[model samples]
Target: MKTREYTFFGGIHPRSYKELSNKYPIEEYLPKSQVIIPLQQHIGAPCTPLVKVNDYVKVGQKIGEANGFVSAPVHSSVSGKVVAIEDRPSSSGKLVKSIVIESDGEFNYDDNIKPNEDINNLKPEEIRYIVREAGIVGMGGATFPTMVKLNPPSDKKIDIVILNGAECEPYLTADHRLMLEKPVDIVHGLLAIMKALGASKGYVGIEDNKQDAIKEIRKACKEYEGVEVAVLKTKYPQGSEKHIIKAITGREVPSGKIPAEIGVVVDNVGTAFAIAEAIKYGKPLIERVVTVTGEGIMTPKNLRVKIGTPFRELIEYCGGFKGTPGKVISGGPMMGIAQYSIDVPVIKGTSGILVLPEDMIALKNPKPCIKCARCVDACPMNLLPLFISAYSLKNDFDKCKEYHAVDCIECGSCSYVCPSKRPLVESIRLAKGEILRKGRK
Candidate 1:
């Protein structure tokens, strides 16, 4: 199999535990009886309701349109009758207008849905438009609009596109399983992205833990030139664009700059496959593979779940928590949001569902930092988390920015390795929020 290697900087070594989902192949879950799709699934302005109560809708039909340039459209995930259109709680813990469809069990699709032209003959603009219309976003959990990323400004020259397959977060194997099963589609999508951006080359960055995925991608890359596969040393936050770019090209995305500004752009592995499907099979971002795992889970499998499936239903599909799961996380432990209830609907950013037993989930009280600097060493971004968190606690927005609060990816590496259990990421997130709010003012 084709193979290459690259280097990256400081990162933490977390217990993987990916074997729980990695051992089992991906399973396609049937559409549940009810689907609650939120209008604000993407990163931008939330979509306005396109339908009222009692509207009959089919699969692959648009239920909500992009509210602005930074936003994305939402589509019906299953064939059903719209029973209600009202405000519902989303995974972000915000109330959003959601279209609740009670499945008729037919799972039918719209007549307008069909494959597009061969990608080779399609224009670059068409490629970007198809991506936008397909409702594709960063499936690695960023949920940023795919078309916007693909359509970078002409002033900024992009040379290399790095496809992220690292799946660095522990207990999540969605990208890992996807790489194993859909290597060709991943390559096709990568090539399409390269064409869209007029990029000279592309590389798939996968962690060494996924040997099977590495092997599969390697085999797929042989036929294509300029497209390469690089195996990275498995590490937390390695999947970060900066880290991936550093590993692949030895280039640093300058402080407070976009990767495109550094002649590079990175896309997630799942995003790549989704692009391929959008262009080839005429599908939107209605469904995705999610890793359902944790010690409290009965069956840990990679499931191709529909978007807007309630967290409760997805958990039940995986056999739910074994005994009494005290906590449910929307993603990996390092960067996931804890849920008080499973009423939230899965969105494009929902990568993993983690359930923890009561005893294991109970967190410890934070103690004063001993100035050990373990967090600084563990931080991939090289920020002073201790100071930033301290400043945030004191509501000092200027001090927080001085410590580069915005650079924090919220990866949770610092907190995971912290001796004081200081909630470094959470505190920094609050600081970043305040800083952003002030900037808007």
Candidate 2:
């Protein structure tokens, strides 16, 4: 396929502060003394605990089973005794039932792991089950169950499956590192997804800044048929579902719809890695690579942390903070949550834990709108953020409805572009909550 620069609608040019941690190769994090694994790590229903207190379990044993089709199973990340199955803070600033395991210091792997005999000879349904049992999700923050994504509506007739390699979010280099370090697994995972979806043609979209990643993927996929690598412009929201679809295929998923409706299904690069593992070695998505870096951090390193590892331990594993942290974010600077505490457990979607120094982390009171309209231009969804924020403030749900507040992708572009420092995105989130509630009622 011919290479080209494809792009989508409105997006911002935020300060790409990736240089802080991009220079280092991804290093494995030494297992902490304890890891607290959350039962509900993905977008589906919470997984029920299959192990009880004091039960000894291996590193790859399934501790939590999905409650339904929407959920993914949870696994133990270390060989140890089950300490407790109780409520613990997740990275999203909420508490959920977690299975805390005390590590035995000796990281032991299950003895049954083996490479697949022949992936092509396996049935498609078998591949889907491997992906589902693997507990994989859209590692790019959506955390939607990957099996559900691969199994779009039979009526949808998806024509394209796109691999999103764009680590568009600044200060997060997990995907970039995965692309560069584990390109083979990534390619295999992409093929596994293609087999699961039965998608004849697929594309890998990587930003220009990650030229090394693009090069790696291109080289890995040279022998594979029906897969092409496409380079995209380095932009903030390039990894967003709709933005990625538009960038590669020039297809617009209409408002109030999913990419499946447009005959496309976008999967994250990391999710592909998990699929590769599930299909090849029968491994599940119990753990992932995480980037723990920021100005307040003593050392910025990419770690392979267990799914339920405590956010505090992950920080301490990196030699603790160099300076006092003013802002502790769970994901990226733009879309990550300003964590209330370090005690939260890292979930599957936990890409990076950024702890900015007191001086580096800036926050100011929301100022009165100056009608600058900078937010209007930055919104990738093309919704009027200022108008939505205004309607939301007035408690005028209908007016907010008129402004399409529900359609906001929450990419943080509006807040990023607002010179007046208006909290347009936060107000819109409130409107979204009210709208969804009312709709449910």
Candidate 3:
């Protein structure tokens, strides 16, 4: 384990609130009634449904086929009958075409899911094929297709692969518990990724707050030739791809470009664990560990939940809400999306479900900017958030674009630190969307 702690510039350290559920062992959660699987869980193209209404689907069976090169497949998390194929509300608050399955109570595995050859014998192409077939995506909530990330363009020579175990978001301990319990599997997954990308070096970047996790992962990396655990300062958005890459390898990903441009590939710790399972046990990315925590939750927990399971069921399994929920976010308080309904199903990107109590929620009105330059100082991307937000509020999107509003990672650090309670990230998000839309046109 590297003793020196690494970090990037411009970030805030919010109360992690990990004590709520960090100590809990992961519990398996199975939805009894229904599992709603969405067609588009990744960043690129939405998938096309492979199974029609009333079709019998088995666990680990691919039900949604990738529609494009940048897309990922979707699989059934339960053995059941497809009762409905309709538009449903996803965690992103968008209406997505989904397949709803009624469980038959028998979790039958698909015959196509069988263990492949040893990791040492598997070729790079074979590894990529298996990852795509298993429908693995970036589990850090980005939901980018893992296969696409692993198979970067031949011109870009990837030499470093990093697994993000930072889990920097507040109220999320799923990744932490995963690191402690399945460190060996995560390391194996890293090895598989390194081989696939032909990267010479691999590192699992974990925040110093998670000492046990670092120790466990370090132990797992001991025998591996080019794998090590890099300790990071516990800061908000430390888990961001660019920041983690910078922290671990001192490589700064250029604005408007990806880590692959700098010859590096970063993946979530959960994504690695899923890859290990897919390669070793022939399991699809049908399930993941989720941290259900908040002061509003009656009983906080870290659960191994199947994809397509409704958020309501998970909350109920964790003893439901302690009081009226002021808000229920999908991932974490910072980067997570505010869910309009708990009816949303857990998707490939779902990390943590945060339930904030009504009393804990503060409804504050925005005041005039005090010009403290706090927002600019807090922005990790080195962009002026206040100016971008002001221009966005004025509908001057061109001005926003000129300020590099599209480069903002929307980490909510500025919003968190602002005394005026300004909607910094929200306005910047609007600006980014408009800028991108105009570019597309």
Candidate 4:
């Protein structure tokens, strides 16, 4: 298949450390002692606990019911008794209510876990119901409920569906491994998503660096019409939903708007696989592929991990740390959140666990901006990051809002290109929080 390379306006080519884990096949890991399933894993309201302490819960059993339309339910990843339901540290550095369960080692499945109707016989509403019931979310770190994307406004016409296989984040390769190992399932999941959204076209966007993944997905798409693999230029943040839409379809999502408004919807490759599994075998979003890697890690490997498993267990399973870990982050280095505790449970949005050695961690003070326009030129959203940072530092959030700081994707492109090592993303993120908070008030 002859395909042209596609990319967005501005993105940095960060050194990809994917080689450390991409070559390793996914290993299945069962929680050793317990699993801590959080109540709120998605973008919306937290789910209400359906099971209390000391209650017997089995794998795939719903433990937390979604309290709102925008949220997704949580399921037990192991067959055990609920030990406790209390506040615990999460990947976001916040204390969230979690359901703790001790493992029974049986790994029993719920009785409701059975095959659904064939895809061809399933209606759009049925597909949406299956997705929602399965608790599938955007596995690409956004953690937005999948059902919400499927059910759009009647006025907005969705014509294209894109599966982001472009694992562009540095040192993360779970999506790439999924694309290579489960291309057919990913394609089937894309078809299910298209059928649900009434969309006619589907595209899988893969970065050019992962040639093997591109080839596998392309081969899988041979029998399917309106589904093709769109090769993307390898760059940081290319896996972003908006950027993938822009690269594949040449459509720009408006500022402060969603892709559905632009007649498109983007889902991660892992999310697609989960949808496929749910439709085929009635599996919930319990286990996910996680890349546990970094220079600080002794054995870097991509493993299929169950949700609610502690980070420390995975690290130890990978042979533990090579030396003193300076920082542990969930997701990629650029956009991932740093973790203060390794005991935090892996939530639905947890993509990868990145551990950096002490020597690699640099603590430097921010210098004054030299006004060289590098930040401006490197901003993917075309916003003035330096000015936004300046205004934000001065506590002039009004000025930050005036500069359209809310439009910033916070991809850290500006910070990566800044010569003075300014914390452009951090300041802009603070300004965005204050602006949104004030607006809500």
Please list the C-alpha lDDT of all candidates, in the order they appear. Answer: 0.88, 0.85, 0.94, 0.93
Taking all chains together, each candidate's TM-score versus the true structure is: 0.97, 0.97, 0.99, 0.99
**Residue 198 displacement in candidate 2 (angstroms):** 1.2
Model 4 residue 361 distance off true place after TM-score fit, in angstroms: 0.9
Model 4 RMSD in angstroms: 0.9
lDDT, candidate 3, 147-218, per-residue tens: 999889889999999999999999999999999999999999999999999999999999999999999999
Model 1 lDDT per residue over 40-73, tens place? 8877888877877888888889889888788888
- Model 3, stretches more than 4 Å misplaced? none
Which tens-of-lDDT digit does each residue in 340-417 have in candidate 4? 999999887888999999999988578889999988877778889999999999999999999999998889999988
Could you tell which candidate, 1 or 3, scores higher by lDDT? Answer: 3
Give each model's clash number. Answer: 0, 3, 0, 0
Q: State the displacement of the C-alpha of residue 355, model 1, in Å, after optimal TM-score superposition.
A: 0.4
lDDT for predicted candidate 3 compared with the true structure = 0.94
In terms of TM-score, how similar is model 1 to the real structure?
0.97
Of the pair 1 and 4, which is ahead by TM-score?
4
Give the distance in Å from residue 60's predicted Cα in candidate 3 to where it truly belongs. 0.9
Off by over 4 Å in 4: none
Q: What is the C-alpha RMSD of each candidate to the true structure, in Å?
A: 1.5, 1.6, 1.0, 0.9
